[model samples]
Target: MKATDRTPADLLRSALSEDPARPLVTFYDDETGERVELSVATFANWVAKTANLLQGEMSAEPGERVALLLPAHWQTAVWLLACSSVGVVADVGGDPAAADHVVAGPGRFEDGLACSGERIALSLAPLGRRFPTPPAGYADYAVEVPSQGDRFAPYAPVDPEECALIVAGAAYTGAEVVEQARADAPGLDLTGPGSRILSALPYDTWDGLAAGLYAPLAAGGSVVLCRNAGLLDDDALARRIESERVTATAR
Candidate 1:
């Protein structure tokens, strides 16, 4: 399917149905040096379950802003997909003041955010830690939500002209640009199963969303998010490209 032929949710549905066992995301933690893999089927189920929880349990109205302060990892992708599934506007923001709801990790920023009324906190545990019980205030993301099981909610018809994401501008700009650069990039093909991508950009930034996330998804390609190009710069990037056999990348 062409990038312009479908919405984000449409592409996700197609991907989930294509190969359930295919690896959708490969997460690597720089702090502990560990790798976690989430299959396309499993990730799709999680997105549906989380979307249900967000819409049913949390009572998050459609078009409501749910701020995500997540790192560039597999969970971020799942959350974005979940929000897209439920029609909730997932605000990937650093500033907590502008968000209606917030999902954060264990840190000063997570603890500092004030929770008023029936606010929900989706917290992540330390890397490689066994599933922990949900505390009085916070909800453990892995444990609290039940798996969507074999069934998934049917995809709601979406208007192609509607806004899907509100990605932050790169550098600093007052006006937000929402063009489909993925459709415009020349020589971009996502028809093969082994297609791979390497991205060193931050997820919250516009370039990262367009290149790292949207482009690959539009092309049905697997993405690898890296921290940096390493000390040797081009040499490290080249090594990664050679090792992963990346077919395409955005500089």
Candidate 2:
């Protein structure tokens, strides 16, 4: 992380400034044989559009809670940074009824309806395809997010000391999250620049979050996130590690 980096958004910005074309997130769904690669600039653009949608359309105020009922996909990573960019607290697997806004995957669509606040739903399909029938009382994220502005600027500066993430019932401020991610990098074997760590951990806990997303960013590296990794045979996994140039593994 740079000296000026405090919030997770800052880490993203630093990455973008350093190398816009460098791959930041490479996601693989072993069950579906789907693979996607997103560069730093591409990911930041998604975050910007999502942030705009949250701040302008949802009217998410600083410190407001956004329940994220998603998994360890690339879109989930986008929403995490988007929440940070807009200064809202991202509550992973949080109580929907208590949130000011909700973003849920297809499987959790019914559960997210408990939130009275604005709700968004992701199909989580390959290539971010929209659902054939939109879920009732929820904005389709693939439909709405595309129309949002490409640039995002928060109305107020995000306080690094303010709570930014709630995972597994523990709240962490933006600064603390960054510090913890930085600390996790070495142990996860992400000490060198351009380190490519492949992770199959879910995003419900800090360890999963660190290994899959934050630690790679903090270490100026990229990640190969695998979902449904158990479905891949040993030979296929070995080929993937070699093809993806993976330097570390986090399970």
In terms of TM-score, the best-performing candidate is: 2
Give the number of the best model, judged by lDDT: 2
Model 1 ranges off by over 4 Å: 2-5, 115-137, 147-150, 154-160, 169-181, 184-193, 228-239
Give lDDT tens digits, candidate 1, residues 82-109: 7666666666764556655666655524
Candidate 2 residues 1-251, lDDT tens each?
59779999999999988888999999999877889999999999999999999999999999999999999999999999999999999999999999999999968999999999999999999999998888999989999999999899999999999999999999999999899999899999998678999999999999999999999999999999999999988998999999999999998
Candidate 1 TM-score to native = 0.76
Where does candidate 1 clash, by residue pair?
Answer: none
What local lDDT does model 2 show for residue 186? 94
